[model samples]
Every structure is written in C-alpha cells, then in structure tokens.
Target: MHMTAQDSRGSRASTIFIVDDDSGTQQLLADTLSYKGYATRCLSSGRLALTAAAEDPPDLILLDVMMPDMDGFEVCRLLKMDQATRFIPVVMVTSFNEKAMRLKGIAAGADDFISKPIDATEILLRTRNLLLVKQYNDFLKEHAGILEQQVRLRTEELEKVIAELRTTHQQLVQQEKMATIGQLTAGIAHEINNPIGFIASNVTSLGKYCERFLTFIKAQQTTLAACLPDPDQAERLQAMGNQLKLERIIDDVPNIIRETMEGVDRLKSIVMDLKCFSRVNDAEQSIADINQCLESTLNIAGNELKYKTIVKREYGELPPFSCHPQQLNQVFMNLLVNAAHAIDTKGEITVRSWSSNGWIHVSISDTGCGISEQHLSRIFEPFFTTKEPGRGTGLGLSISNEIVRNHGGRIEVESLVGQGSTFTVSIPMKSQGHG
Candidate 1:
C-alpha cells in the first residue's frame, strides 16, 4: 500500500532508477513504481544509467543482473565505488534465482536481490523499504554532522553511561562477595564459638574454685579464734586442699587461661585478616605478600569451596611484590568463587603460585563444567557469560582482566570442554608506580 499523501507532503518525493537492458522489463518496472506515486527513470544501458546517476542521483536503483555490455554485479560495483552515487540503494533485478548469484550481488554491493518477473506487490515492498533505509541513513548523516558540533553534550552522555556501568559492575562484585560472606558466617561463628564457649565454661569453674577457697579460709579463721597457737591451721589448710583437689585446680586454671588466651589470639587473627581483605589501602600500591593475599582470600571463599571441592595449594615461597593488596584479594576471590561454581556436586580445585623471571604466576584450576570453545574466546568480554540467567553477572572475568592489566599482568587460560579449565595470572614482580 502507498503511504498517505500527508506522509509524502513534508518528505521529499523519492526517485527510482530502473536499469535493465530488457526494454519490456524496464518499462514494466517504471510503470509499477509510477503507480505507487514514485518518480521513475528508465535506462537500457549501464553507461547511460551511470551518466544519469552522476547528473541527478536517484534514491533507489533497480539493477538487472544480465545486461548487454556489463552484468548487474559489475554495474553495482562501479556504482557503489563512485563517491557521488554510492549511497543510493541498489536492488539486484534478475530471473536467475540462485544462491551464488545472490551472494555475488551482495559482494558487489547490491543492497538487495529480487528475482525477475517481479511481482508488483513484492517490488513495491522491497523498493519502499530500501527507500526508507536510504532516507534514514541520509537523515542520520545530516544529524550526525550536527552532533559533531555538540561534542561536549555527547561526551557527558557517554561518561554517564560509563559511570553507570562501573557502578553496576561494582555492585555485582560486592554481591558475590556478600554471598561468600554469608557462607563464611557459619565457619567464622564456629571459629569464634569455640573460644567463647570454653571461656564461659572456664569462668564458671573458676567461680566454684573461689567459693571452695572461701569456705576453707573461714574454717581456718574459726580455728585461729578457738585456741592455742592457731591449732595447726597450716595442717588443716593442707588437709582441706587435698580433700578439694586444690593442686589440680591450680594447675588447670593456668592451663585454661592459656587456652583462652590462645583462642582470643586466633579470633584476633581472623578479624585482622578480614580487615586486611577489606582495607581501603587498595587506594595505594604497596609491597604485599602474594601468598598471604591468596591465603586470606581462600579463607574468605572457604565456605564456597569446603563442600564442593578439595583444595590443594602448591604455593611457592613468594617475595613481596608491589600491588594493591585489596584489589588482588578481589581478583583471587573472584577466581576462587568461579572455581567453586564450576563444580556440579563435587570436584577438585588447585591453586598454584610461583615466581619466575621477575614475574609472579598464580593459577586457579577447577574440575567443573569447562567453558566451551565457542565461549572461551569471549570469556573476558563484558556481559558475556555462560552461566544461567540469574546465576551470575558476567563481569567477574572482565573485571579481573582489567585489574590484571592495570597491574601490568596477563592471564592465560587452558580448558577442555568437559574436563576442566585453568586460569593463570602473571603479574610483574615490581609493578608500575612502585617506588
């Protein structure tokens, strides 16, 4: 159906050029387009068409595949190659309905291909769509030039998008960390529970010990008052001590205090590790023990791995390297959590590290669902994920890649589709900005 006259009023009238050596076909196409209220020009030769196009370009060209001097492909190529008429949409017109001819036409810059003995309705639809596309492209070009004048506005828009993306990515990372923290709730409580529980028990026992000593003191005082020379209070005290097993209580009280102190120390260590993991020291690069970073990160991810896999650590002795410890901890946490998720019910995760040639190498390998070859290449691409919907935000590896690159590091991956995958990160021992 033709668009309303109102649609055509403000918009420029589109011109169609029918280029075909077949006089009958050309006339028919011209009449069909003319009936659609489109202006039409017919040319029987590619040479004439080229000349006319350069003189006055048409909005869309219907090109015949078989011509006398030049074929449709060559004519289309020459038309597209020219600067003046290249934007005009070329529709390949031919009776040859074959895949090869269609591909050839496409290769030669034909915007569309329509088989010959063209249906009036089909021609109208195809031509109309092509005209619309050309007009839209022209409109874009015009507005794009206007946009070039408003660079600051466009830049502000871009920055806003970038900021939003960064915020979203951070939220995703924090969400994963929070999930890990939830898993750690039980383990950390268990760690703290032991010490506090024992300390409470010890306090109760210490209170009973004090009461027994008080009773013995009262008995000694009564003896002192009753008679001659305090009536062997020392002997009575010794007998009372043996009866109450005071020696054992004295020895055990010291031991309980020591154990409680050790437990308190352990609790302090865990709290300190958690603090270090979350420290704002990430704002500056500093010398850090990579092994310690990994160990602390492993602790954070312990709950994720404990039930799912057996973790083996073949950590080489590491020299302190300049890095943002908190950021590296983030990287390690992401890797560890990913490894844990890769497993179905149970599997093995191996974390290995070493230093070579002034570089530190750390690897996390998992026997889980390995990435398919098709997806492996895009693993570090933002928003590309193989994980099921609502399962993960694909930004983990992407963020890891950014962090590694910022630290002057590179990551290498090896994976088999069903067997396993290994991601190795190698960073400079002395990263840039290290003083």
Candidate 2:
C-alpha cells in the first residue's frame, strides 16, 4: 500500500485527509494523526478524496497508491493541478520498493511518501514540517495585502493635498488679476466722474435757460398780437406761428433737457457704484449702510443678472454697521452672480435685509437650480465646484465665507434640488474687528 498527504494549516488543529481503499490503512492513519492533536477525514476512494478536499479543503491530504478506482499518483497530480488545492503539501504512501514508483510519485508533485507497514512517527514528522511551510506562506500573503491597502490610502491623501495646492495657486493668480482690474476701474471712474459733473451742471443750466426763453417767446407773441390790432395782420402772424410749429417746440425743449439731465444722473450713479465696488482700500474699516452696499453690488452686477433674472430688494431700516464696505460688496456680488448662474432661464433673485437681536441678516434667495444635499456641505470648500472647466475656480463661496467670518459673521444656506436656494448672511451689529 502507498499513500500521500498535503498540508496548509494555521493555528487551528491541522486537518488531515486520509484516502485509501483499505479500511485498516485508513483507520490507522486517522488514529495516528488524531492522536497528535490533528483533525482527520477518512475516505474510501480517490474520487471521494478529491471531492471532499475541494468542497472543504483540509490542512493536509493523505493519498493511497494502488487503489481499485484511482492510484495515489493520479490523485496527487489532480490535487496539485487545482489552484485552490495546489498549495497543500502532498505526501505519498506506498508498500512498493521499486525506484520507478518513487520517481512516479515525485513526478506527480508528491512532497513526501510513506511506505506501508507505515510508521506513525514518520508520518507525523513529515506532516508537521509541511504545515509549518504553509503557515509561513499565508503570513506573507496577508502582509502583502495590508501593505497594498496602506499604499492606496496614502495615495489618496497625497492627491487631496495636491488639489488644495492647485486651488491656492489659482486663487493667488485671480487676486492679482482683480487688483489690476480694480486700479484700472478706479482710474476710469474718476475720469468719467469729472465729465459727468460738467454735463450734469450744464444740463441743469440749459433747462433753466430754455424755460426763460420759452416764457419770453410767449410774451412776445402776446405783444405782437396786441400791437397788430388789425385782423389780417393777426391772422398772418398766427399762420407764421403754425408754419414754424413754435408751440410744440416750446413744449418739447424743457422735456428734452429734463430727460437729458435724468440720464446724466443715472450715469453718475453707475460711476459712483463702480467706484465704491472697486475700492482698493480693502483693509480699512468704516461706518457703512449694509443696504447701500447691496444696492451698489446689484448695480455693478446688473448686466450679469439682468438677462436671466429679476432682482427684488426688500431692505429694512438698520443702524450704521462697522465693516469693510468693499469686501462686503464683493461677497454680495459673488452670491448674486452665483444665484443668476444657477437659474437656467428666467427666474427671480430676492435680496432681503433686516436687523434683529443685535444681528443684521441679509438673505439672497433665488428661484434657480438648487444644490444637492451631498454637495451642499462642500460648497464652501475651496476648489469644489459644479461648474464646467474654465467657467469657475470654485473659490467664490470660500472667500465669501472667510470674509464674513473675519467680520464676526456667518453664512447659512438652505436648498432644494429642483426648487431653489437661499443663502443668508448674519453679522453682529458691532463687529469684533471694529474699534
């Protein structure tokens, strides 16, 4: 009789599979292994051993040679061929003394062999050695898996840091660009303001002068009518007046001058808002009406919002607040423009401001596409944006939040995916940064 065994056991009692056609041999092997504190499964045929080993792999396999169905060599070869069972160390048992049979067992992937009239001590020693090697292989595999997971986690963290660096660099570039634009805008506004003043004054004077001229023309017409006295001369004078359309001209001149002056006033307001919105002295704190700041931001951002949205202002009276007006204006502009972009087509952006409980609240609500719950929390995180590339740098909300916090304020947002969104900014009436 001949047999083989394989092993892959850890800390648990090593399970050994005993496969042989002889009942005595099977019983002998099971008893020997069991006595050594190892678990043993006995099977009568090679097919039974293969099926049992595959279904529930043992730590070791004991295979028999010279069976009625299949021999130990064939069984060992089959076990070694399977990826799941291949690692199990196979020990072949045989009664034959032929060198050819030992070579055949070796060729079949047998790790060791036991000859019949099997020595229990020899079998135990061989089984112990094979199991030790299997345990070491398992340890190596587990270690490699842990190292792979660690590398994956570290890679993700590195990527996150790189993204933040890119965002900071982009923000610096944008700030520099804005600084240059602010300087240019301030210069242009100053130059335009002087000409606007001249035009406005001239228009006012021109309106007054035209009114006096019209009064004189009316008096002259009356004097001419009284002096002519003759009906034919009076009729001829009336015909000349009709031909000249003098009455219509007298009525239209004052209205034209009035409209011109109104245009001049509107232009002046725009320039003033532009100047206030682009003020370069951002670090200086001053007394400012928050409502006026919102109005100025709205005017400066009018073109961006007007095409797709209707802006509604609901401002309540509040005391003078201490803050950087220009920075607040910047925050409002960012929020307003973002609201407009959220809207797909026509929508309404409501700017509401009020004061209560020593805090001033300004809420900008939009009837536009609102943020999802998943993305809402990260909206103020730098470099997080839903906008397409080149359309956004994702720093608007981040910068706005920072500015508000510096003024002892906070920004809160509420949104519904399809309906709309409301962003409310609350500031302490007396800011900590102010003197």
Candidate 3:
C-alpha cells in the first residue's frame, strides 16, 4: 500500500481525501478533484489513510467501499467515532450495486454515498455541494453570535434615549411653571394693592377722627373742673358733649375701625395665598400644598372671575406632595383663566384635587362655552387656539401639556359646547431623574 498527503493548492481552498485500493481509481479521483480546483490526496489502503488523516485532517473524506485489510465502512466508522475527525464530511465511493452494501456504509456513519465508476462531473458536483453547505453552516453559527451581540448593544442604546427624554421633559415643565408665575405676578400685585390702598386710607382717616375726639374730651374736662362750683357745670358739660357728638361717634368709630382693619388683614391673607401659588421662595422640588396653590390662583385670578363666574372648590384628603410647586401653580392658573373665558354669562368654576396610586390629580372644571369635539383633540397642539384674535396666544394649553409631560404626568380635557369644560392634570409622586 502507498500513502500520499497533498496540501490544498488554493490558498483558503478546501481539501479532499481519496482512499481506494486500485491505483487507477485513486489516480482518477485525484485528477478529477484536483481539476475541479479542490486539493486532493490519494491513498492505496485504509490503514495508511487513517495514519495520514490523524496527522492532519482534510475538509472532506471519500472512502472506497472495497479494500483488502479493512473495508471502507470500518474506516468511516472509526473516523466518525473520533471526536477530532467527526466534524469532517465523508462520502463513500463504491462499485457495489447492492442496497444492503450502501446501507451498511451509511450505517457506518458515511455522510453520503456515491456509486462507481464515478462520473467526474458527479464527483465534482457532490464535492462542491457538500463544501458549500458546510461553509454556509459555519457562517450561520458565526452570524448568530454577532447578532446576539448587536441586540445587546441596541437595547442599551434605547434605554439611554428613554432616560434622556425623561430628563428633558421635567426641565421643560419647571421652566413653564416659572414663566406663568412671572406673568401673573403683575396682575396679582395689582389685585392685592387695591384693598391695601383703601385700608391704608381708612386707617389714616380713623387716626384723625380719634385725635378730634380726644381734643373735644379734653375741652369738656377743663370746662367741668372750672365750673363745678355752680349748677352751670352740668349745662356746660352737656353743651361740650353735644358739640363733640361724643355719644354716636364714640359708639360707632371703634366698630368701623375694627371692620376696616379686618378687611386689611383679609387682603394680606389673599396676598399670602398669591405668594404660595407662585412658589417664588421654594426650591425646585419641595413639599407642596395643592390647596394653597389653588387658593392663590383663585385670588390672583379673582378679577377675571368676579363678573363672569362663581368659583367653588371640592377638595379631597390629599397628602403633601414633593413637586415643582411653581409649575403646578401655572397649570392651575391656566385652567382657571381658561374656565373664566369660556363663560359668556354668569357660570361656575370648580377646582378639585386628590391623591391615588402614588399620584396627585387636580381637576379644574368650568361652566362656560365648552369645546367642540373637533377642537378638543387639537387643543394641546402648540399654537392652536379657538379664541378670538388677540384674546388667545394659542400657547397656554400647549405649554401646559408640555409641563405635565415633563413632570411624568398627563393632562386631559373634557368639554361640551355651551355646557362647560374640565381640565385634569396628573403627576407622578417621584422624579424619574435624568437619563
């Protein structure tokens, strides 16, 4: 028996091993495989083949069915059982026409069966197909690994994007809140100043009245001390009391002064409510009282509501919330003003708030000309307005919507034409920090 091992001629080309007892058969296979651009090796016996293959495996194996010392089936069986050589594809080549012989070869672990005398074309075609299939299988395995890696990387990127979006949203909400408060400051100051002006005037007048009364009383005391020697002292005292009008002035002045002072104090409370609503002194995120914000909004918007609407509040038991209080105050103000504008005649505005499921919900409802179905959907879209020109800037609802979204919340509106409208805002309890 003779043995030969040939390295693949083509760089990066696959190799084929041919084992046969007939020199002619070996020469024929070698020429055929080599002509087809595959590197080929020809061996005269199975023993020499085993030795050569164990030394350096080929990409594929073609074993002859008939051999003297050992048949092709036994060689194939041994090769299949070996862990190092099992991955190599083996095709049995034989002149045997019996079905049992082919089955025996397959049962011995041959990857495929080819009958001889082999057609050169058939040999080439089978080799090409098997090699191509093996290459594709390897590629699929490698590609799957790369695909898994890509999936992991893409998931991480998406998570980063979601986090960034959350952070940007919160910032926008805070900015809108500050803007609304800034706009309302002038109007609120004007409202508070009116009562303060009148109260100050009333206090000044009361001071003068007290001084006049004190002077008149001193006059009466001097006259009485001088005239006590005669009955005319009684006449003089009565005359002085008449001049001072001490009876009625003393009775009514203190009550008037007290009432005026109470009015001034009430005005001060309203101003305090405005301060709370705007949250000018609070931090970005702090414990906020929603009821206080609502009250301030009502006071700041009092002039807008006084003639056209009656305001009512239906407050629920709510816990103190940590939030951007100024922003929430802006939302309240927008809804209230919108409600006030909705009414053509006397109507009602209702503000309600409560907490549930780790969230705070505030609803402002108005009995005014309600929104049309067509308009409701577009209400939150930036620059959309149903108000007459110059009456609406078209940014209020849009800005409010943006603010709510930033706070990890949502705003919804319900309205009916000629009936009224309601705007509800919901915000999460905790800030979902920056992405």
What TM-score does candidate 1 reach? 0.36
Q: Could you estimate the TM-score for every candidate? A: 0.36, 0.61, 0.36
* Cα error of candidate 3 at position 362, Å: 0.7
Poorly placed runs, candidate 2 (over 4 Å): 1-14, 19-23, 31-58, 63-129, 229-245, 280-363, 368-418, 424-435
Clashing pairs in 1: none
Residue 254 error for model 1, in Å? 47
lDDT of 3 by residue, 1-435 (tens): 111222222345577889999999889899887775677888888898888888998888899988999999999999988877777788999888789998898899988878897898888778776776656655676789999999999999999999999989976876686567545854776677787987778797876888688778778777777768876767777788889887777777777777777768766655644554343334386788888988898899899999978888898887887777777777788788889898888999999988898888999999899999888877875447888865665657765675676678889888889888989998877745311
Predicted structure 1: clash tally:
0
Local distance difference test, each candidate: 0.80, 0.84, 0.78
Query: CA shift at 70, candidate 3, in angstroms?
Result: 85
By TM-score rank, best first, the candidates go 2, 3, 1
lDDT of 1: 0.80
lDDT of 1 by residue, 1-435 (tens): 244211233465688899999889988998888887888889998888999999999888999988989888888999999999999999999898999889998999999988877899999999878887776787788889888869978899999999999999986985586446534643665566676667767766775776687678667656755664655775686688799987687657667756666766556544444433323234577789999999999998999899979999989988897788877888888889888998999899999999999999999999988988888887876556778864665657766765786687888899997788999999998676322
Ranking of candidates on lDDT, top first:
2, 1, 3
